[model samples]
Every structure is written in structure tokens, then in C-alpha cells.
Target chain A: MDIVCDKRAGGTLLQVNGRMDAVYAPAFEKECLLVIDGGEIKVVVDLTGLEYISSAGLRSILVSAKKAKVKGCSIQFCGVSGMVEEVFKISGLFTLFSIVPTVEEAFAA
Target chain B: MMKPQGIAFRLASLTLLVSTIILAIIVGYNYSVSRKIIVALAEDRGTLLAKSTAKKISTAFMTVQKVIDSVAFSLEDDRLTEKRVNELGQRVLINNPEIFGSAIAFEPFSFQHDNQYYAPYHYRLDGGPIVFARLGSDDYQYFYMDWYQLPRELERPIWTEPYFDKGGGYELMTTYTVPFYRNRDGQKVLQGVVTADISISWVQKLISSLSSREAEYVFLLSRYGTFIAHPNANLVMNETVFTAAESLEYPQLREVGRRMVAGETGVVELNDLPMTGDSFLYFSPLPDQHWSVGFVCSKKEMLAEVSRLNREVATLGGLGFVALALLITFLAKRITHPLRELTVSANDMASGNLEARLPEATTKDEVGELTHSFQAMRESIKNYIENLTETTAAKERIESELRIAHDIQMGILPKLFPAFPEHREFDIYASIEPAKEVGGDLYDFFFVDENNFCFLVGDVSGKGVPAAFFMAVTKTLLKVVAESRLEPGEILAKVNDDLAEDNKSCMFVTLFLAIIDIRTGVVRYASAGHNPPLLLPKNKDAEWIPPLNELVAGIMEGTQYTTKSMTMHPGDTLFIYTDGVTEAMDKMNNLYSEDQLMVVTNQCLGKSAEQLVDSVDKSLKKFTGGAEQSDDITMLAMQYLGKGSKQEGDDRWI
Candidate 1:
């Protein structure tokens, strides 16, 4: 799995690729933690390449969101597609966090 | 003693045997070559001597034949009478002293030779000469009356028999005669014959010298096979032939002799001998004499060299035997010395001294390398044994220390069950069993006020003394916070701060604490990442009542704890436990899962607090088989019956 990150306009953009199962979840959590700790107030995770998501992967995402909240950083997820979108809707994570279709929409949020 | 030494001995022995066999073969060949050389030399010398004798004899025969031919030619023509013939004879005698006398005879009394030409002389039988006119009662027996008549019959010059000569009158003499024709008709015509009367002493002397050398016999034979001069004088002038040639055993030699008579000169063996040894004869035919000379020498004498060779081979064989013996002894010692040392070293190593090392020599041969390998193996084994001993001792020591820690951990739990035997506000029971040397599960309950009882069950993560230490700290902090007159939520908040203040290694604990008002059966509870406790209603079914709160207690500093309140009805029981109780596993790896735990807890819904704990414990054992508990299984059960006097049969609840 690949997580490409770029910073623009004082916000972090993370592009995640590949399935986020139990094996890739830990890396995703570490990436999100690094961004939050950098004092980035607004961060975006692009899940356009995400094909599938397991419960453990969702839990890592939620944990990262809570960690960001504690640090007073706002996290937004964009480009959610495939099974990752369905998992978010079923887990009620979409109600808890902002979701956008593109990176521009995430930055606006 | 060792395999290499044994092989070396066999190899050395084999080498010795091979060398000995080769030496024997060489000795045999040398013997054969020397014998051939000696035989060749003997044959060459024999042939050379025989040829020298033939050359000398030929020269002597030429001189003698020449002298005889000159005398015969001188007498060939006779122009005078008997008086001149006698004068010629005397002259011949004076000129050639080697000739005894020369005489001439004429048939019909017409001869002139010697002194008794036509005289009527009588031959003397004893020693005297007699006048022919005074012969004893015989009237003038003339020359025709003598043995000379025998020559006239044959008509050839011949050597007459030895007789007492009246003319010479001293020694026995034989007459050599030659007959000739007086006319041109080429017939004898009764011409006078010339006679030479020679002494036999010279022929005897020649035969004696030739026979004196080493089994050699010289003999002369006439052209008609008559023995003239021989080693046996009696056989001289006798008509004799080689009788052995007629024997069947000499058929090959007979054939050879026939060819020899036809003038072949080579080698032939005389096989027909009456007790005569093996002989090799070399024959040379004399050209003028019409006779042959043969040298008969024994074959043993010609090949005496082979005997000398036998003696030389004996000497060489003796030397070879001595050399072989010395080499075998020396080789045995040289080969076995190293082997003996190796044998002793092997014996020492077999006796279980891993430290025992074979001595290595400085050479780079196989034996030296073997010694180095053995020493290296010994050294490695010693090091391995030492390391194994230390590791085993260290493991035992650690296990013993862990056992002590486990005992200390168990001692910390409240071993005195049924702490209040007389109080009847609620019936309560609790148990804690650590999984390892130490565990993080802890249970505590104390009366916060006259009406309120503060009870809690918490499990810290991980195992060992660290978790044990953390559980102790958390339990102590909970007690301190409970005495501060705070509610369940506030008490948890205070404890969390105290535990997380100096926390390293990210250690945390999951806790469920509740404060109950036994008078009203009202309880307030808070959770910190802990599974919810099960509550059994008095008339309804027992179920899990989950509390809503974020993970508190060491997860983050200043993390708040929240509480949920519930009013208890009569005979209702509350069960609180660490996850160890639900997460326990069997040998099949199936868990005492939470779903199973809930079903079991609801089975005895209306049971008292102690009955509820007992039923759950029994169910956990049945579900887990005989598999050991994998964690600290700690539980606290409490019940609140309605605050009133009960019936007589309900006394067991008090």
C-alpha cells in the first residue's frame, strides 16, 4: 500500500492506495498520526485507490480521527470509492466525519 | 594396532616379497647368462686348440711326404749295377741321417739297393745275420723267398710287418716300399721295388705325447681301414674299423661318419660307447694320408663352467636373504611408532575427557592433519558443554525467581473469602488468579459511606511483574480517590491521572467501577475501555448493560470518565469481571468468549450473588476443558435485595 502525502496552503493531503486491511491499517494509522502531530489543522486522506476495508482498518481510521481531534486538528476524508465507501456508510463513520468526493472539496470542508 | 599401521605392515611385507621374487628372477637370469658365456669360451678354446693341432700336423705331414718323394725320384732311374746301388744307398744314408736305410730291389735278380742286393742272405730270427750259402739246412733262400713276396701279390708299396732286420740287425723295423713300372706300358713288369726300413721308436714317441693330454687318444689308420700307429701298439698294422658304428644307438653318428668318410668335417657325438662318457668328436681328414684325425673330448669337461655359476648364485642368494630380513625389521619399526601413539591417544579420548586433546606434529602429512582435527573437535566439545551448563543454570534460576514472584502476587489477593460473614446488606464474592508469575487483574470493594459500597474490577494490559506493579498502583489510587467523597466517575478520573502521570511503555488498564446505595439499591458505574458488567433484574432476564465513555485510564492525560446510573430491584445481582474471565481459551483454541459468558450468566438469572459467581466459574471450567487459564481471572459479584425483613426461607441470602 502506498500513502503519498503533500502539503499545500498549510494543509496536509494524503493519497492512500491499495486495500486497507489489518496489515495496512497500522501504516495508515502511523501516517495519520504523523500528520496530526505536525500541527496541521486541516488534513485530507484521499481514498481513491482503496479497494476494500476491514473492521480493524476502520477502527484505525477512527482512532486517528480521535487523535487528531484531541490535538485540535480537523481531519477530512476524500475520494472514498469501492468497498471503502460502503464500509464507511455501514459503520456510521460517515456521520461522524466529513467526507468529500475530491481533494478540493476536502479542502473546502 | 591401528588400520594404517596394519596396512603398512602388509604393504611392506608385500614389497619385500615382490623384491625377493624379483631378486630370485635376476639371480636366475644372471646364472643363465654366465653359464652361456662360460660354455661359449670353453667351446671357442677347444676349437682353437683343435685347429692349432691340425695346422701343426699338416705341416709335419708335408715335410715328411716331401722327403719321401725326393728319395723315390732319385731312385726312379737306374743306369748302373748293384755296386752303384750300394754306393747310392750309403750316400743317401750319409746325407739324411733321419732315414735309417734305403734299399732297391729288382725282380729276377736284377736289383741294386742297400748292401744285400742279390746276395743269398738269410733273415735272422734271433739277432745274427747269416750268409745265404750257409743257411741252416736251406740252400740260399733268396730275397724272393722272404715276406717280400706278399707285396708282389698286391703289386703295391706297403708297410711290412715289423721283424728282426738282418741288414740293420739292431731294432725291430718295418719296410716302407713303392713298386714302379720299368717300361712305358704303364704296368709293373716286375720292376725292382724301393724299400725304407724305419725304426718304430719314433712312432711310439708321437703316439705317447698325443694321448697324454686329458682323455685324448691318437691313432693312425691305413686307407684300407688298417690300424698302423695306435696308442695300443698291439693293434698297429691291424685291419680294424670302428665297430661302434654298427650299433643301433649310433645310427645318427653312423650316418655322420659315412658323410665324414665322404669328406665332411664338422661335429658329431659318439653315442655308442661301452661305459664311455658323452664325447664330442671333431674330425679333420688328412689330404695326403687318406685318413682322418678326430679329437674326442668329454662334454662335461667342455661345460665345467656351469658348476662355477652354481656357486656364485648361492652366494648372491645368501646376501639377498640378509638384506630382506634387515629391511623388514626396520620398516616395521618406522611404520608402527606413529600408530602406537595414536592408539594410546584414542584410548584416552574414549574415556570421556572432552578436554583431552591429541598431540599434533608439525608435518603436513595425513597423520598430522588427523591429530589437528581431533584436537579441534575436543576443544569445540568442551566449549559447547560449558555453554550448555551455564545456560541451563541461568534458566533454572530465572524460573525459581518467577515462582517467588507468583507467590507474592497471589498473596496480594484477598485470600480470606466471605470477608463479612454477619453483614446482610449484600452477599459478595471475589477471586483473582494470575496467569503467569504476576498478573494485572485486581478486585476491591469498600464501604464509601453508611449507605454506599464502592466496588471495582480492573485489568491492566500485559503480564509479569510490571503489570503486577501497575495493578497495585491502580488499586491503591482507587482506594485513595474513593475516600475523597467523589462519585464513581470522579474517582476513576482521579485514579487515571495518578496512574498515567509517570507511565512509560504505554501501559494501561481497563476498569469498571461502581458505587452502590444499598438502602435504595441504586448504583452509579463508570467504564474505562472495560467490557460492560451484567445486571440481573429481579423479575426480568439478566443482560449486559454497556456504559458509554471514551477509553480513559492511562490512554491520554486528563481523559474524562463518565458514569451511567441504574436503579436495582429486589434480588437483583451485578457481576463485574476482567476480560480474563471471558477470554480464557481451551486446548482447541476456542475461547470462553463473551457471548458464551452472557448465556451462562443468564442461565442462573435469579440466583444470589455467590450462586452467580459459582455458576459462571463452573461454566468457564466446562467450556475451557482442562486447559489452564491464560490470564488473571478476577471477578466481583454483588447483590441488592429490597431493604426489608424477608421470609423465613430466605435467610441464606443474609
Candidate 2:
């Protein structure tokens, strides 16, 4: 899994790529945790390059979500569709946060 | 040599010490024996010379006295009185040729002389005519000399120590003086003494001729301790033994001189002499004159032959010692070389070179035995490693092939979600996780026809290649029957018959297969010894449908399955799974039973088919907490949306 974190206008743009299964979930968590630890409250995860994800990856995102909320920070996801979108919809995490179609729109939300 | 702790050095040193001690003993013995022999010979020669010289002096004195006695007896009645005394003395000198000089001295006034001293002394110059001198003068006090006074005091003829008679104008001489009487009264009266002068040259000549060796010198010392005749001309008649001992600083010479003067006969060893090396002095006293004859011999010259013998013995012993040392070194090396080779071989083995070879031992010693054992051990190690490597390779090959089979089996399952994307009537998703590299669980879905869709979840009877092969054949048969226009129940029943007809291995698959017509909003489902799916109604909680109680597929030839009909509402969902889901376990061996599945599904209300499956999967992983998955888990979920119904907002990207 490749978690590319970039600085944006309103937050850190974290681009998640590749299969975020149980083997790669910890790396996804660590990338988000580093941004939060650096005092960057607002985060945007770009799923444009993401090819696949599993339940273990979902758990990590859920934990990151709760942490961001408690810290008065917000996390938005952009560029999601197909199997990854269905995974979020089935796990009921689609209603938990703002999901946008593009990086610009995610940070705007 | 390896550590300076070998026996060769010890042997060499031992030989050195033993040979040194033996050589010292032999040399010391030789020295003492040679010294004793030389000293004994010297003492014997000195004693013989001393005795003969004393006898010669005595005989000379006796002959002169006898001649004087005969002359005195002839003159007793005035037969040629003092007129013939001179002629008689001349005759005595000519008769005794060994004497360098002969003299007859007379007492004064009674020998027909008018002077108070009428003594006449006659001595021959070397091989010359006899010279005469008158001793009647006061300066010629021959009447008071030891030659005159000592014999007169004892009333016997005595030989005097040799002395230079300068006043008498004679040679260095020893005088034998005897008294002659004249009848001046009736009682025996004192008359003129008769003296014979014997030159000391003859005795000195005797000493010189005694020995021919240069280091062996003979000398005589007077009773008064003066040197009389010595090889050293400066000491002859000039130095006494006491004075020479002090000047030479050879303290032992004092003892020698004392012994000589005391008429002692012995040999003394003198060490550290000035001009000569160590020497031995042998002395014997001439009692007639109380003089001593001594022979001096150098110790070096005396022991020269013994030293030569010592040198020869040392050379021979040294050669022998060298030979012994070489032999010992060679033998020691011969014994220890094999041990060194063994050490090297052992080191090579420790470094993992089992093929290292030791040289063959021919001696049948313990080293040879060790070599045989080591060879056997090496062979054993080689065989052991070869067997281990072969066994491990076989196991790895089997495991790798199983992994490839697992990949193929997992590939054949339908993994793409929303299986019918153009058909908005339903969304379906499924997944299969095997317990091992290859599993017995399988799930697949496809279009039976244009309007009818088919899907199924199943588990075979066992795990691994056999069950996986069986699962594949069963799955393919079902697809063929579904395409042949058979109902879901008939399709499974036909697949079962086809499978049971030729199946030699007793294998089975528990299947829950379904076909639905999206246009009619109806789902036709069948169960063959499989778990029923949960119907999650649009308005209420989900529930398990009653089982059809049919025989499982691939168990019997004519196993018939029953169908159940259910019309799905626009939002109703169907969740079907194998027993692996219900029987999933945690580390403590706690099972995720049917009750737990329902409890987990309660959180899936309003979720899509994919989300519902993922949520259950998440729950299984969570429940198990990373424990080993011991069974295959297979699940298929489908949500039906009735015709003409659509998502609130939707966009499909090309």
C-alpha cells in the first residue's frame, strides 16, 4: 500500500493507493496518525489511486475517523467508486463522514 | 618445537648434563693418577740422587782421611815429617780426580813452622796447575773456621757445606777436616788439622746432569738454607730457599725449604708460580752434609698426556651426543606428526568441510583407529545432510503446488462486485477464504439466461487437492445444467446425479443455490444439506429461512433438492453463507455460532450487499482476533431493487 501524504490549502492530502488489506492497513493508519500527531487537524484522503481495500483497512479508517473527530479535526475522502465505494457503503461508514468526488471538493467540505 | 615443551630439548639437556658429569669424573681421575705417578717418580729419583750424593761425599771424605791417616802414621816416628806434607797433598789431588781441589791444612808451631799459624791451602784452578797459599797469617784464621772448629769440637772428621773459599784462594769447596797429633807431651795433645778441599763444581755438575727435560730442574740447598747448585744461575750460591720463596711469592716453597733443611724427604706441589706453570717440588736431604737435593717439574708437562686423552674423550662423546640428539628429535617428530595432522583434520571438520581427508596411518596405532572413526563419522554426516535436504525439497515442492492450486481455485470464483452492472434490479457480492492453501469451500454466481441470474455458496466434505478438484467439477456441472434451462432445484439434482454416478471417492458439497428473475421480483432457491440464507426485509430485522431438508449434493445418485419461493421487496436483502462462517473460531476455540452471526447482522441494517458481506467478514476477523483460520469461509450476498426503482442519486462513469 502506498499512502502519499501531501500538504493542501486546508489540510494534509493523503493519497491512498493499492490493496489496503490486513497486510497494508497498519501503514495506512501510520500515515494518518503522523498527520494528526503533527497538529494537522483537517485531513483529506484521496482514493483516486486506491485499487482495493478489506475489512481490516476499513477498521483503520474508522479508528482514524473517531480520533480526528475527538481532536476537533475532520477527515474527508475523495475519488471513490467501484469495489472501494461499495465496501464503504456496506460497512455503513459512508454516512460517518463527508465523501467527495475530487480533491478540491473534499477539502472544501 | 610447537610450544617449546617437547621431549627433544629435555633429552639433549639430559645428555649434556650426564656427559658433563662423566667427563669431569674421568678427567679428575686421570689428573690425580698422572699427578701421583709423576710425583712418585720425581720423589724416588730425588731420594736416590740425594742418597748417592751423600755417599759420594762420605766416600771422598773417607778416602782423603785414609790417605791423611796413612801419612800421619808414616810421620809418627818422624818418617819425612812436614817436608813431605806438601808433596803428599799434591799426590792426593792428583789421585782423586772427581775433586776439583784438595787441601791439607796444619795447626801452627807444631808442624816445624816458626809462625803461630802454619796452615797451607792448596786448590787447583780449573784444569790448571795447583795453586798454594799460606794460611799462617792472622787474616787466614782457618783455625777458627767451621771446617776446623766443628770437627775439633766433636773430635771427629765432618764434611762441611760447600762454600766459596775466597780467603784461601780456592774454588767453592766442601772441606773434610781431620786433626793430626804430635807427641809434645805424654797426654794426647792438639796438633795441626789435616783438611781436604773438594771443589763444589763436581756436585753442581751432578745436579745439572740429573735431568734432561727443560721444565725438570735439579738444585741443591745448603743446610744453612742457601742455594748451592741451581739451574738458575742467579740463585746458585746467592739465594736461600726462604729468600727465594718470599721473592717468588710462592708460599709453598717455604714449606719445601723447611722440610729440606730439617732433613725431611718429600714432594710438594707448587701452584701459581711466576715463571713456570704449576710445578711439583721433590726434596731429599744429604745427611752427610745436611744439604738437600731437589727436583722441580712443571705440572702441565707432567699431565700433558692425560689432558690429550681427555680431549679425545670429549670429542668422541660430543659426536655421540649429537647423534643421539638427532635420533631423539627424529623419533619424536615421527610420533607427533600424525597428531598434528589429526588436529588439522579436526579443525577442517569443525569449519564444515566434511570431505577433508587425513593421511592413511600404517602403524596400527591409536591414531590410525581414530582416523577410521573420523572417516565413518564424516560419511554419516554426509548421508544425514543429503537425506535432510532431499526431504525438505520434497515438502517444499508439495507446498508450492498446493499454493498454485489454491490460486486457481480462488480465481475461478466470481469476485467482481455488482455482478450485473447494467441490471439495476439487484446488487450481489461474494468472497471465499480457504483454511489452507487449497480449500473445500466454493462460491460462484453467473447469468443462467438473459433474464434469469444464478448464484450459489457451497462447502466440500474435506480440504486439500482432492476436495478442491471435486468442488471444481461440481461447480462446472452446475453451471452447465443452469444454462440448459433447468430450475435451481433441478440444476443441483442433475449435478448431484452426474457427480455421484462416477465418484469413487466419497466426497460431497453442501450447497445453497438460487436463481432469480429480476423482471418478476421472484427468487427460486434450493438447499442441499446447506445453511439457509437470512432474509433481511426492507421493514424488519433479518431472519433465517427454514431449511429444505434435502440430501447434500454428490452424496447419492438421485438426491432430490426442494425449492422455496420468496419475492424480494425493493430493499430486501439476501445473505447466504457456508458452515465455515458459523463455525469460525477464536484463539480460545470459541465458535462464531449462528446466534453470533445474527447478532453481528443486526448492525447491517441499511447496508448494501457488499457492505453487509464486508461487515460480517470484519466481525469474523475481530471475533477470531488473528487466530488461525481452521476452516474455509464462503459468503454470497444479494440485495434486490424492484423494477423501475433507482438510487436517490446515481452517476455511472464510463
Candidate 3:
């Protein structure tokens, strides 16, 4: 998983590609916290390149989202496709997070 | 050849040949017996039918000829007159079984033998010989030059060409004439001609039926080759003579005719007649005539015997060939079973399954020898792997022990940050990760007095237990001097004196010791030939403070070390580290240089002492990126956050 922050939108864009499973979740969480603790809020996580997200990956995202909320930030997701999109929909996180179809839409919002 | 496939092929060949020969014998014997029985049965029926037909025809011919002879004797030798001759001809025609009619012809009477002379036989209107000696004036002139007189001049028995009788419209009649002669005087006097005006329809029907029914043909030829008995008698009498030798298509039949004309009778092949693949030819001479009869049948009928034999032999041969194949395959498998086992074992060995052993064999063959070699190989491999595993375990144990030793050596150093927690004037941090099980690098920091904080970082020569022990001792003795009343330079000098006195191993430590006055941020540091610690000036680039002496620890005891003072302004940072810190490796094996450390210190130049340390640690990690550290690394940092910004609760940053 790769994360790039755009300060203009006050959002961190996480462009994850390939499998985000149990082994990669911790490192992903640590990196997410690094950006969160930097005091940026209104985070938009771009999942356009993310091919898969398992339960562990989802849990890590929720934890990071909670941590961002504690720091007075909101994490919006965008460009969810493939199994990752289905997972988000099934978990009802599609309704929970501000999910948009593209990164541009999320950034605009 | 000794090759097993060769033996198999040879055995198969031998078995096939033997079975074929046996099959041939059985089939030939059966066919010969069957063919003999069939041929004998056919020949018996054919011969019986042919001979019986010939006898019946001959008996009828003789009886008819005898009746005609009796009529001729009555007309010529009995001196019968024309009326008597006519009556006798009528009686012959009526009494004979086969003669259709009999008649006589003689010269007109010239008053022979006192007016009692013989006359020719006469026939009535119905074509019977009428044996009358005279003709009535109105009886159709029976004695007026008979037609048989003309044919009588011919030397041979003349069969007059058939002529139609007007009285019997479309009825064909022909006369067979014979001359009557008197004996005893040898006179050439012709008494009269005896003739028979026989109806030829019976002979015509017989010949027509004979040739017209099937492929069989019969035609009579005179001695001069004239056709006599024929289906169309008039055609034979009118047309050219029938000759079998006139054809090119029947050269063999011509040979048969030649032989018949030469009086030789037997059989010969008829190369013509559109004979099939093979055919049988039979020829026989008719008795008392130059004519011969030829018969031909397809030879397929004759060779059916051989064809049946061949078919049976082929079937039996196929069965025998199948048996031979099975036997060869079975025998080959039996011969190669042991070799196949050996091959399997060999393959197993090649695939690294060395535990696979050939099965025990009692046969004293090359395969058994191979089994022995395989067993040996298996045993050797097992022993070698066992030894390898033991060696690997031992090496692991040694490695873990070395790791423990390394930790214990680190435990000997001052590793904690803020060594004097209550001293706010000086913020101190140090860290170490050894390069190996143990090394001689050491760093120490403690408060020497209420106003002075003391710390030393050093690297010893060589490594492992000897260097680590010397590090421990030197660290202890440095503390002893610092606890006494010595400055940083004097403490290192005293420790050097004590360390060099017993330095038999000739090892040394490059050290930089410092004392900081907490109330003023003035740090007085001394170095013994080590990399200078970093100092960041207020609003300036960080620089390394030059060491004051050339002596390393554990060298000559009298070596003098000098001291340099750096007065830290408020909000200025100071960083110090051993050479291991600057010399630490990154992923590419590039050193984390002093310039990089200087940048680290200056980047946090205005931050508190703790932030300076944190920045350096972060930079080190970013530069390392999972590269194995190569030396014992230690760094000490301090900063003056200044008195005005030092809030009561946040004074921890000072």
C-alpha cells in the first residue's frame, strides 16, 4: 500500500495496489497514523488502484479512520473497485464513509 | 545378440515359423482329402452320363442301318421287280425302329435274266420306301432318272444335300446311297444304287439342341472336312467346312485339333474361350471318326481346393502369430523384471530419494550387483545428511550464544536517554546496537556534579571478548575519575594512565568526553583522537568540534588531552556521537557520514535536545532502510530551549 498526501484538499490519498492482507496491515496502519498524527483532517483515501482488501485490511482502515476521527478528521474513500468495493458495500462502510466514484469527486467534496 | 529384445524377436520368429508350418500341414492334409472326395464324385457322375448317352445313340444307329440294308438286299440280290421293291421298302419303313424311309435305284430294265430283273425301291407319297418293281403309268414316274444317280457317281458314301419335298412342304429329305455289287467274277458291274430318303429332322433337332442349349457345340465333319451332322445342315452343306484350327484366339484349341487330326487324343489347355483365372480343358476322340469333342471349365473350380487351404492356413497363422506375440511379451517381461526394479531404484536415487533401496535379490547377475551399489549409495547419503544436520544445529547454537553475548555487552554500556532525569540544563540521549556478538565500542554519560554532566563515547581496537572486557574496565575507571574532582580532559587522562599500565593486549579506545554546565549551557568537551561531536551555533551551520588530543584510550598513560568549550546559546542544539554512528551502513552499504549527522543536528538546531535526538534517529532509519548495522552505534544530543520559553510544565524540553 502506498499513501500520498495532498495538502490542498486536506486529504491523504492512499493508492493501494494488489493484496492488502494481514501481513501488510500493521505497516499500513503505522503509515496511516504517521499521516494522521500530522494534524491533517478531511482525509480522502483513493482506492482506484487497490485490487483487493481482506478483513484485516478493512480492520486496519477502520482503526486508522477512528484514530483520524479522534484527531478531528474525517476519512472519505473514493474509487473502490473489484472485491474491495464489494467488501465495502457488504460491510455497509459504503454508507458509513463518504464514498465517491473518483478521486476528483472526493477531492472536490 | 545378447540383447534381450533380440532374444524376444528370435523367439517370436521361431514360434511363428513353427506354428505356420504345423498349420500348413494340417490345412493341406484336410484340403487334399476333401478335394479328392469332391473330384471323384464329379468325375463319376460325368463319365456315367456321357457313356450311357453314347451307347443309346449307337444302338439306334445300328438298328436303322440294318433295316436299310435289308431293304437294299431285297431290291438288288433278291431279284425283286419294281413292284416287289416298292412293297419291300414300305415294309422296311414300317418295321424298322429308327429308319424314316428306305428306297432303291437302278438303271432302267433292259430285260435282264429272261425278263425277271431287279428294280430300284420306290417310295410312296408319304416318303416310305415302297419296294415296287414297276411304276404305273400314273404313279408319278418312279423310274425316271432318280436323283440319287447323280450322287452315286461319287466314290464316298454320298449324303445328298437336303432338299425340300414339294409333297411334304418344308420337310427336308436326304438320301444315303449304297451300291449293290455281285461277287465271284470280279466284274465292275454296278447292279443298282441303294438309297435312303431319310427325314433329317431328328438328327437336326439333336444337333440343334446339343449346341444351342449352353456353351456346348457339336458339328459333324466329313473326312474331307465337310460338315455333316450340324444344327443347320443346309448351312454346313452350302458354306465352308467347319474347322477349329482357323482361329487365332484358340491357339491351344488349334493344338488340340492338330493332335486330333494326328490321331492323338488327350487333354490340353484352351487358351481362348475367355477362360477365367484358371480353367480345365478336356478333349476326347469320337470312335471311328476324325472328330473330337473339347470341354472347358473355369480353373477356379479346380483350384478351389488350394484356395480353401490357403484361407484356412491364413486364419490359423493369424492365431499362432497372436500367441507368439503374447509369449514374447511375457518372456521379455520375465527376463527384464529385475532390471526394471534396478532402474526404478536408480531413478529414485537420481530424484534425490536416496532412501530408496533395491529389493533383495538372490540371482547372481549384474542386476544384483547393481542392487549392492544402490544400497551402498543409500547408506552413504544417509550418513552424510545426518552429519550435515548435526553441524547445522551446532552452528545455530553458537550463533544464538553470540547474540546473547552481544546483548550482555550492550547491557554494560549507558544506553538509557536522560541519564540524569532531574537535570534540566542538559538533555542527554544515547543509543547503541552492536555490530556482532560483542564489540569494544562504549558510551557513558552521568552527572559528575550538580553543575557538570559528564558523558564519554569511545571505540576500542579489535573486537569480541578481549575488547569488550577492556571496554568494561575502562568504563569503570572513567567513572571513578569523573566521580573524583577531575574535569572531562583530566578524567580521561587519569583513566588512560590506569588503562595503559596493564594494556598487554596493546588495544585502544578513541573517546570524546564532555562536561556540561547545566545552568549556562557551556559544554567543555575533550577528545582522544575520535570523531568530533557536532555543535550547532545559533542561526549557523553545525560543525564538528575538533578533538584536543591525539591519544586514544589504553595507550600511553602520560598522554595529555586538551579541552574545548562551546557556549550554547539559548535554543541552540548540540549533538555528539561515536564514529559508529557516522559510519553506520545503509542498504547500499554507503556510510551515514559526518556531513549527514551535521545536517541532522542543524535541522533540529532550534528544537529541544530530545527533538534533536529524535530527528537524527528518524533520519538514520530513513537512510538505513533495513540494512544490517555494521558497528556499535551511539549518539548523544542536548539542546538549550532557553529560560524564557521553558514553561513550568514544558521544562522537560530543556
Question: Top DockQ: which candidate number?
Answer: 1
Candidates 1 onward: DockQ, in order: 0.08, 0.01, 0.01
Off by over 4 Å in 2: A1-109, B1-80, B131-133, B180-186, B212-215, B319-654
Model 1 scores a C-alpha lDDT of 0.66
Per-residue error (Å), model 2, residue B131: 4.2
lDDT value, residue B122 of candidate 2: 62
Error of 2 at B114 (Å): 1.8
lDDT of 1 by residue, B400-455 (tens): 98898788767766667676555556667887777777788888888887878888
Classified by CAPRI criteria, candidate 2 counts as incorrect
Model 1 lDDT at residue B444: 87
Regions of candidate 3 where Cα sits further than 4 Å from its true position: A1-109, B1-358, B361-366, B437-440, B461-474, B484-487, B490-508, B547-560, B585-589, B640-654
Per-residue lDDT of A13-85 in model 1, one digit per residue for the tens? 9988976654677898899899899899988989998765544466567678778888999899999875576
What would the C-alpha RMSD of candidate 1 be, to one decimal place? Answer: 12.6
Name the better of 1 and 3 by DockQ: 1
lDDT: worst 10-residue window of model 2 chain B:
B645-654
